[model samples]
Target: MVFIRWFLGKCILLINALTLPKPMLRIKADQDKVDKKTQFFTLYQFEACPFCVKVRRFIRKNSLKIDLKDAKNNMANKSELVNNGGKHKVPCLKIEKLNEKTMWLYESDAIIAFLAKETELS
Candidate 1:
């Protein structure tokens, strides 16, 4: 079972690398503004999870530069996901606003939708 999972993970990564999507082009000022907004977001994910990959592909294709925290291999990240985020789930998005409470968003489709709405980059 472990070997199968490892093999599938490697295959998924290879496919992701080969079919990497190109980012959409934006004016310098517009892109800068988007970057500023993305700085407050962090994605907690496992490198090989298919759902995580889906969110990552959308992020890359839209040129969103959100931070990625590996919740699988990194113990600290795993703990944070479980404790603060209230769940151990991949593709979880952590949104930190200056005066608002932090938001922990889960599920790949929901994450993608939220990102699309927030960044206007779907």
Candidate 2:
């Protein structure tokens, strides 16, 4: 009975860890490069969402310039980004570009790769 209880307890702990939201690193911009080529990769994500965390990690670690849109609690941004994206999904990216629109790009990995190429610091 003791062993069974211990095993069950461990399993429960594992499940909790797996279900918990992943943490993300939020960084502040240091320069005034806002009005350049693109208006930074506008990202809509939550601090605990894993997929969102990954994208943020890439941006933070590389110190890439980006406009973060927190959609978990910010209902206005949530509706705009998610509804605009047509899936109400977190971690949605908004690439502001002239000759193109938001449909110009979508997807986390793709956005990450684009930043990596541009920054060349990744």
Candidate whose TM-score is highest: 1
Write down the lDDT of every candidate, Cα atoms only. 0.94, 0.64
lDDT of 1 at 40: 93
Q: Write the per-residue lDDT of candidate 1 for residues 56-121, one digit (tens) a residue.
A: 999999999999999999999999989999999788999999989999999999999998888873
Best of the candidates, lDDT = 1
Q: Give the alpha carbon lDDT tens digit for every residue of 8-66 in model 2.
A: 65665565556544433333342233224335568887655656666767765655567
TM-score result, candidate 2 = 0.61
- Can you list the residue pairs that collide in candidate 2? none
